[model samples]
Target chain A: AQSVTQPDIHITVSEGASLELRCNYSYGATPYLFWYVQSPGQGLQLLLKYFSGDTLVQGIKGFEAEFKRSQSSFNLRKPSVHWSDAAEYFCAVGALSNTGKLIFGQGTTLQVKP
Target chain B: VTQSSRYLVKRTGEKVFLECVQDMDHENMFWYRQDPGMGLKLIYYSVGAGITDKGEVPNGYNVSRSTTEDFPLRLELAAPSQTSVYFCASSSDRNTEAFFGQGTRLTVV
Candidate 1:
């Protein structure tokens, strides 16, 4: 069984401020990690994913994540966030054995403060 | 492109249905289970995730998702446990990420 955990339930940041979202996963072997965003009354959108090779993976909208094998963490970071960045963010881990099922985190809601 | 409209929240012991249509002719269609304080759980996934397969969950549900463009999940007998937000997703390739539906919130008594 694989699982993902996002410690923060909600985070508020001012516009133009840097942002960091924490994510941790529990898996037996090497895990496939992904970050997704969901706007209010909207579907989930892919932010980024990490499979192999580089520890740091870049994603759309100037967002990036660093995969730390030792920490069992893949944290999403952005140098600056806009008001439009406010949304529900989810962290997911893919199954390697079969089905390619994605186990997601509890989700962190970002609130941009003006 | 993928778009899902908000469905009227249904109660328990009622029949629940949701349809997702994809214009891109995606090969993969998936249903994810989500609850408050819990993230999305893979319930039924078909197509590019290496064949059609459903995950470990409560039964009494039927899905005929043979077509790549249209996929629907039907709950013949909904229960209290089935009260959760359901999302449908589609992806063109197995390696790429999927686009998700807006999600339908179902409340079962």
Candidate 2:
């Protein structure tokens, strides 16, 4: 079935450094992709989504993601990482059914070092 | 202002109840309800009151949607393996984004 995979389990980056989190998905048809961020002990916050339009999508908190159809990937990126940017990131694919069910990736925990 | 932010329960044969309510009049409600492990697995979801469906991992868990405002999850027998943060979310429709709760850190020991 449909699934999402985030290759990196944990990543550490210095403050002000660029960041990229990889994500791959498996689906039968055109997939609806989304990126979510969760702070410690907090609920998930939507970062961005790619439904059908442009490959590059911008989201809240200065986050952006690119959906590559050929690679079946939706990768998140940030030009400059901040201390507050350290959080667990998840990539998800929406099921075709109208339930809005989402298959999520294992998640990548990003830690920022000063 | 947040609901079900944290829960700590002893591992007893007795049942554990998890409740969720949505004030936005959302058409969909989900329990499990977001990520804590490998990824966020949908345990159960309801389209409306009295209408619920199983999701990716539904075993050992039961749910009931009594009203549009309330969707509660029931664990028949609490187990240590059930120790994970639980989240509740709602959405207006399948195409729209879901709104999530602060999450409940359920620790079963």
Candidate 3:
């Protein structure tokens, strides 16, 4: 069984400020990792994913995450966040054994203040 | 030039719900669930990651699915085990992650 723990429930940052959302996972083997975003009333959207190779994986909307084997963490970071960047972010673990079933974290609600 | 089919490769945004395609596709039903009405909940399944379920509750399948139930990726009587007293039981759809009607919304006061 796999699960994700997102320490932060909600985050607030200035529009131009940098942002970092932490994520930790529990898995038997090296698992597939992903980050997704959701607006006020919408579906979950993929921001980035880490499957293999390159500890650091870049994704859409200038977002990126690093897979740290030692820490068992894949944290999402952005140099500067835009107003639209404010949304709910989730960390997911996609197990190889399971085709595409992702175990998701509770989710962090990001608030970008202008 | 290639003519677009009824199926549009509609590029929406970074917010894409793409059930990723893998080369060695050994499907074990990969479902990404989302609550329908109020809050987001586990309301969808992917009998096979690539195959969209058929019509209504339709198990419409695609050709890319592999057969290997030995994986034993079955969903039977799972429990979130929240303090919420109400218990709701309903069959789920392993189809598109976006479309699902009749969802259960349980809130604990």
Scoring only the second chain, what is candidate 3's TM-score? 0.20
Please compute the TM-score of chain B alone for each predicted structure, in the order given: 0.84, 0.89, 0.20
Docking class of 3: incorrect
lDDT of 1 by residue, A1-114 (tens): 577899999999999999999999999988889999998877888999998999999999999999999999999999999999999999988776544567889999999999
The predicted structure with the larger DockQ, 1 or 2, is 2
Ranking by lDDT: 2, 1, 3
Tens-place lDDT per residue, model 3, B66-107, is 332211112222233221111111112211122112212222
Each model's lDDT comes to 0.82, 0.85, 0.54
Displacement of residue A31 (Cα, Å) in model 3 is 0.9
- Which 10 residues in a row give candidate 1 chain B its minimum summed lDDT? B1-10
Q: How close is candidate 3 to the true structure, as a TM-score?
A: 0.59
What docking grade does candidate 1 earn?
medium
Q: Which regions of candidate 1 are displaced past 4 Å?
A: B1-4, B48-51
Choose the strongest candidate by DockQ: 2
True contacts kept of each: 0.66, 0.66, 0.04
For residues A24-111, write the lDDT of model 3, one tens digit per residue.
9999998788887877544456688887899999999999999999999999999999999988898877644433455678788899
How does model 3 score on DockQ?
Answer: 0.09
- Model 2 spans with C-alpha error above 4 angstroms: B33-37
CAPRI tier for the interface of model 2: medium
Q: Name the candidate, 2 or 3, with the larger lDDT value.
A: 2
